[model samples]
Target: NVYADSIEWMSRHLNHRENVILSLHPHNDRGTAVAAAELGYMAGADRIEGCLFGNGERTGNVDLVALGVNLFTQGIDPQIDFSDIDQVKRTAEYCNQLPVPERSPWAGDLVFTAFSGSHQDAIKKGFEAMDARAAAEGVSVDELEWAVPYLPIDPKDLGRSYEAVIRVNSQSGKGGVAYLLKTDHAIDLPRRLQIEFSGVVQSTTDAEGGEVTSDQIWAIFTDEYLPSQVADERWGRFELLGTRTSSDMTGDVELHARLRDGDDVEDTTGHGNGPIAAFLEIVRGRGFDISLYDYVEHTLSAGGDAQAAAYVELQIDGERLWGVGIDGDISTASLKAIVSGVNRAIRTRQLESRLAAV
Candidate 1:
């Protein structure tokens, strides 16, 4: 700050001098070199001296990347393109044989990240608002103003997806966990379900005393919602090998399916008003106390050849559970969903029996 005052006074007196080029060079010894440089620039400094990533002796120099990005965020073209910040950081590190710090200004790994519960919630809401605005205005989110809580600029501008912005730690809450699930897996949870699953995630993180990655979150989600057999074996006990269905003019539906349960296989037929109903009837006839409580089919994406996702809620022997399935064919996906729910209930009952015996 003292140097800043001196620079301003000298620049004012030397402004009218012929052929005078005023330059300001600040070091990071006080850890305010970047701030001092900015202030000196505003006070009439002609040039700043620094290196990439602030790499220098005695706690590094004024970071040029930080300065350029600072100018970029303020809508000023610093004539330096940090569009590929990772490449720049890598080059700097390779040339200097010194790695950049993880918290180095805008180029840091978590410069735009928010790990706190409230911060994550605010960032999530901010993204939603930005998306809504982009949609209403007929533009990409990148085209709109880059504003999100705890993040000064979009990491995308720096060639970073940074989906890990809301890192999941033991202190994280539902919003942060839910955000990662949707961002990474395209699986959006209902508010109630989000709260419930957040408890599971909290317990896991607390026991581990570490951060949970997005992939781990997805694994937990599948373990909780998909068929236990499928979760492990990739095919459940009640696997739908094949199916043939026909509808008559009288509005009656008949479905014949080759179903497998462990080592046994059977070709069974059932009749109902619809194919799904007929399939459920066949499953019922197999001596499984299962009934479809609710079925929801949602689009995963708007792309052609995209697989359909089915959510099946089944009421089995007075208890209910949810299962999910995905396939190219809607019918197969829906039936797999039923089988998934059935397999899940069967697995739960088996576990209970084993526990009772123990």
Candidate 2:
């Protein structure tokens, strides 16, 4: 109130002739320099002076970056260019030898990153919809209105890519992992797969006690699902040879499967209400105790020729596991998911046995 009153008094009495320009230079003695500067501007001050990153004695001076960006976000031009804020932060840190907090507004490492599941999901979907709309309208991304979740300003406007916007940690969720994979590797995972992968990421990060990088996540994905048919001798327990499904007018479905299990090849026939059920019955008849709990499928890419992705969750002996598969055919993808799930379950049991021995 005193600062505003002083500014008002000066503007009214000292600058009555309109021959003088009032300026404000506020300190951080009370840690309100930025507020003082903003108020001074509104109170008719023509100019305000502050140091970068609030680097001064005591609490230092007001943070010009914060003040300026505050104005920029309000659709007001602060007449300052902060398009490359990371560079600005680097320069400041180098010259001052003072580290900036990771949560610093607009200039920190994790400022643009989201860890919560809901936030990550909203942000991911928001960016996707924005891009689709921009492409449909034949306009640049900048021309589109900015309304991303949990982000006040577009990071790209500051020369930052979306790669770092969603990082995975123990507290992260399915959407964050999916966003990272999609942005970094162009692999768009289905929703169920995202959930499945999030569990893997959480476990890895929990064990490592830190953030999981994109490369590590990709390695896990490949190791879990992309085993070679011929090179993976351990996976010879079940190799899909061929499958045929027939549906009659009464809605009855019959499935015939030829499977090679460890040098013992055999043909099996089963009847169920659906293809997956029939396949499960065949496996059950072979002495495997597996039950399907959940299933989800989606197209990985756009257009008619896009690839499909499927995710399956199975309960095997009271333990649950998830699997993912991708292919040009939806049915094939689902079957692949089943195979992946069984393989993962087997691996889990082996790991448990080893740990118990240890």
**RMSD list, candidates in order:** 4.6, 3.7
Top-TM-score candidate index: 2
lDDT of 2: 0.82
Query: What lDDT does each candidate get?
Result: 0.81, 0.82
Candidate 2 backbone overlaps, count: 0
* lDDT of candidate 2 over 92-202, digit per residue (tens): 999999988888767888889988888999999999999999999999888988988888888887778777888878888999888888887667776666887788788
Error of 1 at 7 (Å): 5.7
TM-score of each: 0.72, 0.81
Residue 226 C-alpha lDDT in model 2: 54
Which regions in candidate 2 have their CA more than 4 angstroms from the true location? Answer: 15-17, 56-58, 88-102, 116-118, 125-142, 185-196, 225-230, 233-237, 241-274, 303-305, 317-320, 350-358
